[model samples]
Target: MQLNISRGPKATGKTVRLRQTAMKAGIKEKNILIGTSYPDRELEAKVLQLALRGLKVICIDECREEQLAFLRRVKDLICNSVTVHVVVAN
Candidate 1:
């Protein structure tokens, strides 16, 4: 199954809760990925690496209007791939 979650600050907890719930329901840690894009390049690399390792990728972007469209494109790419959950957080 695949899921794309978009959210603002309030939804931060929601994402974590969802991941935790999914894990408790039997999802492996390696199969669940969480991340944010506002950090530094090193962090981005780490997130990407983790996602590439076969986990879901949840990218958090805090209300960056210009990035919305770009993120949509990225979502499409992720949906077609075998890896990544591809979440976009505002």
Candidate 2:
């Protein structure tokens, strides 16, 4: 698993940079999963499931603190060598 972080104030180019990284990684669009970092079980589960299904890149934009904690609890369980995690936050 690889982790890339984009942290800055709002209106910064964090999202753009992460997206560019994902694009440049040469993965297919369907192999790239974009999601939000809120405390939603369905959303969180989808992120993990798709990663397990072989997504090459994962993007979590605007992560909330609680959601970050939740993800941290399960990141190891879902992390794979071929996957890249791009985490964007303020």
Candidate 3:
């Protein structure tokens, strides 16, 4: 699997970059799952769950350390063909 980690200060257009990458990769919006630690945790978890189901692309924004750990634990769930984009905005 391809893993991309985007790190930068807040409001650096991380989400926009991820979206562009996803589009370039030909992953449909429905097949793309976005997980954000801000605003809501439950919603992020739900989105991550969908990503574990072999979604085309998975983007995690403002990710926490624990969330990174969770990704490691579920790494096997992501297929080799899938690409994961992680955006960490400070």
Candidate 4:
């Protein structure tokens, strides 16, 4: 499953909560990925680790202007899938 998470400052906590729920559901810690619109390679890597461990990745774009493009890419990735969730950042 692909989840597009966007909710300003809440996105971070939302991501964490999703992971927690997934963990409680017995989902392995290797299928979740988290992403962000802001650039932070290190943080991104850490988030990736967390996601790969069992949460969705946190995507953070190095280029702010490329965020939309990233979203488009993500959309493309999920097009062939059966389910998708888009969390818009307010």
Q: Which candidate is the best by lDDT?
A: 3
In candidate 1, what are the lDDT values of residues 33-54, reduced to their tens digit?
4443444444344544544666
| Per-residue alpha-carbon lDDT of candidate 4 for residues 7-70, written as tens digits (9 for 90 to 100) | 5454466556555655665554464433343443543344434444554433332223334444
TM-score of each: 0.36, 0.68, 0.60, 0.33
Question: What does candidate 3's lDDT look like per residue over 1-90, in tens digits?
Answer: 556778777787887887787778776655445455344446445545656675766656566655555666556755667667877646
- lDDT by residue (20-45, candidate 2, tens digit) is 76678765455445545245565567
Give residue 90's lDDT in candidate 1 (0 to 100). 52
Best by TM-score: 2
Candidate ranking (lDDT, best to worst) = 3, 2, 1, 4
Return whichever of 1 and 2 wins on lDDT: 2
lDDT of each: 0.46, 0.61, 0.63, 0.42
Give lDDT: candidate 2, residue 76. Answer: 78
- The clash count of every prediction, one per candidate, is 0, 0, 0, 22
Candidates arranged by TM-score, highest first: 2, 3, 1, 4
Clashing pairs in 1: none
How many Å off is the CA of 47 in candidate 4? Answer: 15
- Model 4: lDDT to the true structure: 0.42
